[model samples]
Target: MSHAIAADQREHRRLQLAPTIIRADIEQDGKSREGYLINVSLGGAFLSIADPPAKDTTTTDLHMLLPWGIGECHVQARTVWEQTDDQERAIGAGISFIDLSEDASNQLQSYLDRFKELSIEITS
Candidate 1:
């Protein structure tokens, strides 16, 4: 399926963040490892990891290091899907937000809104 179609079918829209290294802390199986946020939305984010865990877990704790002074935002997420490379190696994971606090939700929404506004201005 095309990217646009998938996005349309999703519960919450995703924003393809600019090429910036946004660090993330993915904690699973009582361990914490570093990852990168590939895309983000109100629901969850797609993460890029160099070395993903061999064992797949249902849920994880993610801490996003937002830029522009947005700082770190924490959320509980579940691994809903995965993306593999041509060799059938898991390169990225697609997650769904489980429990989102009101403050974190607001902060994420505001950050996304700013980017959306910028994109609109650039296009128009």
Candidate 2:
């Protein structure tokens, strides 16, 4: 298959997560709480949180903290999957980042560099 076709079948950058636990701050209903990042793709991310809203929670402000710094991206998220953690904490959320600002997107990309390096190290 062509490279493009293979790439299309995969998510952006095929990011190889490093199992690094990253924190996410999600706010809704006039309240905010912390969540842990499961993994990330170029256009979206999965998070573990308690009692996340239903699917298609559109036009919500999501704050993602990367190693470089904190990034604020507007997102339209949906509840793709949900499950309780070992601690019996409700977790699991999928978010489709949308209309991200150029700068914000750039920051996210830069942060993913760490994952790339980790992937290289493992492969080698």
lDDT (Cα atoms) of all candidates against the true structure? 0.72, 0.64
Q: Note the residue pairs that clash in candidate 1.
A: none
Q: How does residue 45 of candidate 2 score in lDDT?
A: 69
TM-score per prediction, in order, is: 0.73, 0.67
lDDT, model 1, position 61? 82
Question: In candidate 2, what are the lDDT values of residues 10-114, reduced to their tens digit?
Answer: 764465444556777777767777777666765666677767666766654567657644445434454544565556653776666677677776777676776
lDDT of 1 by residue, 1-124 (tens): 9998587546355344443346889898888999887667777667778655443456788888776677789988876667767476538777677778998987787777777777789899
Over 4 Å off in model 1, which ranges? 1-9, 13-21, 53-56, 86-90
State the lDDT at 97 in candidate 1: 75
Model 2 / residue 11 / CA error / Å: 5.3
